[model samples]
Target: MQAPQREEIHLNVPSYKKNRSGIAKFVVLPELIKSLLSLAHGNADVECGFSENAALITDDRSSLSDISINGLRATKDAVKFYGQGKVHKVPICKGLLDNVKEAHSRYQVDQEITQRILEKKEAIVAAAKLTKHKELVLVGKEQNLIGQRKILQEDLENVSKMLNEGNSRLEATVATKNFAGVEMAQLLIGGAKKKLDVLKTQLGDNSDQMNQLKKN
Candidate 1:
């Protein structure tokens, strides 16, 4: 069997446009130049030339692949060299370009993942700080409750002692015939005992609620 013959293809070479001073030619790809010119000048008749190898792929596909490959290589070089800011101008071969594009996409995904992790860390820190502040406020409220409980206990003890003394006085006065002094002492002692009981109940309820909040 005969090997397939390699075909020779002819292409018209397009001249690069030089500035009026002729110091340097614009370093853009030919396809980009054609597109810009067509867009700017409204599709004037312009001739473009390419070799058979260049024309093997459609212009759009070739240009897109070239740009993607170039961008990938640039990114790779930048990372490898630690932000050296130099784009390695490597030629875009088909297989190499595909691999580079895939790597670049993965790199982008990795960057997004890293960013999300950092944001989550920041959010966690903020939440922790808020929790700490709330704990501090709870501590202050707990201290206040303890103080109130102590005061209520002291008041209850004083009222109980007075009530006992008042009963003793009533008994003695009943025997000694001092009715006015006994009645006055009984009224004052009873009111103080009732107030002290109410305070104790309120303090007990407050303590329970505070404990529940701390558990939560």
Candidate 2:
């Protein structure tokens, strides 16, 4: 009247009932059970170390050598655990505790010295960057002065050409004996020549100043 019974398996009892899935319904993962059972105190240890490590290895510490940093961190963790009464976790023996203590003290001193060296290196790098910035500013100023000098020289040449053209035209007009409009033409030409001369003088002075700046 009843089907043959499958073997019953029990959680931690080695005998329990199985569901249709063929797994022991009363059985559970041992590790999961242990973890759940340990929650009797309803407290958990948050691994703050992951976040601390993330913060510590910021942009500045990202460049640290992996091997050297790993060694330092390992030693630091051992010291912290030992100080926190977790000495059993650390591979330290009571017989050599004195030697380990002395070594830890020396490690602390070396860490302080390393910290100072890093600070000095940062200061030196900052100073070099400041000097480089000053040099760049000076170079930009020189380039600007040179460009102004070039512009002034070009302007002087243009004014000189205009002055020469005015003089040549006046001479041609005189040769033609154009008496009717000669006076007005001469006035206009003279005015233009005067303005051109003034401009030429200014440009020439600017050119000289530019050359002086170049020498300096």
Candidate 3:
């Protein structure tokens, strides 16, 4: 049935609704009504497609079959592609219309699968780069530690030589049997020993760490 015209809705005169003239439609002819019912019944299946689409946009989401969703996307693509004159660029399958929408639908599914594969490949490459960056950072830390360890060892060796020289000088002073010289040499030797002990402790810790690093 046709709806009210725009002018009819704008009319606010008292006579329109008072005379029951606002309601324009009443009895539909029998054959016309029958034909309308038949058309509505036949169009039910088409309208049901909107129900599926409605679910996609609504809070009560529903899952459609893969084939159905693919075909739907392909249909949208088909319209745009045909408008741009690119639909014929594709190799039309034999008896495409006869086989329903399978011709374009299978292509859409394949394209989707290919896109997913490309995305996965990109993810893998990104992960690999991250792992490599972590490894590089670890290597830099190890190199810094090794350099610090070598410096500590060299300091320890230099302190050992200085301590040995002090001990030798102390012995020479003692050989002279001079009390003042002995006291001075002993003080120097004591200071040398203290420095030597600290160096030895540092070297010991560094050696242990180097050993562990080697094992790893």
Best by TM-score: 1
Better of 1 and 2 by lDDT: 1
Q: What is the lDDT of residue 179 in candidate 2?
A: 63
TM-score of 1: 0.50
Model 3 C-alpha lDDT per residue in residues 1-216, reported as the tens digit of each score: 898754454453232343346554323444454464456537777786676567444454346556667567566566566555366564466675656667578768878997999999999999999999977876776787789878877877776777777777778877877656766667777877898788778778877876766665
lDDT per residue as tens, model 1, 62-132: 65455455565555655556535544544446976788679879879867997999999999999999999
Error of 3 at 104 (Å): 6.3
For residues 56-162, what per-residue lDDT tens digits would candidate 2 score against the true structure? 57897787666556765676676677766364566667756787678779878888998999999999999999999977876777787677767767765775676
Look at candidate 2 and tell me the lDDT of residue 103: 77
Q: Any runs in candidate 2 off by more than 4 Å, and if so which?
A: 1-108, 177-216
Q: Which order, best to worst by lDDT?
A: 3, 1, 2
Model 2 residue 29 CA deviation in Å = 62
On the 0 to 100 scale, the lDDT of residue 103 in model 1 is 82
Clashing pairs in 3: none
What is candidate 1's CA lDDT for residue 180? 76
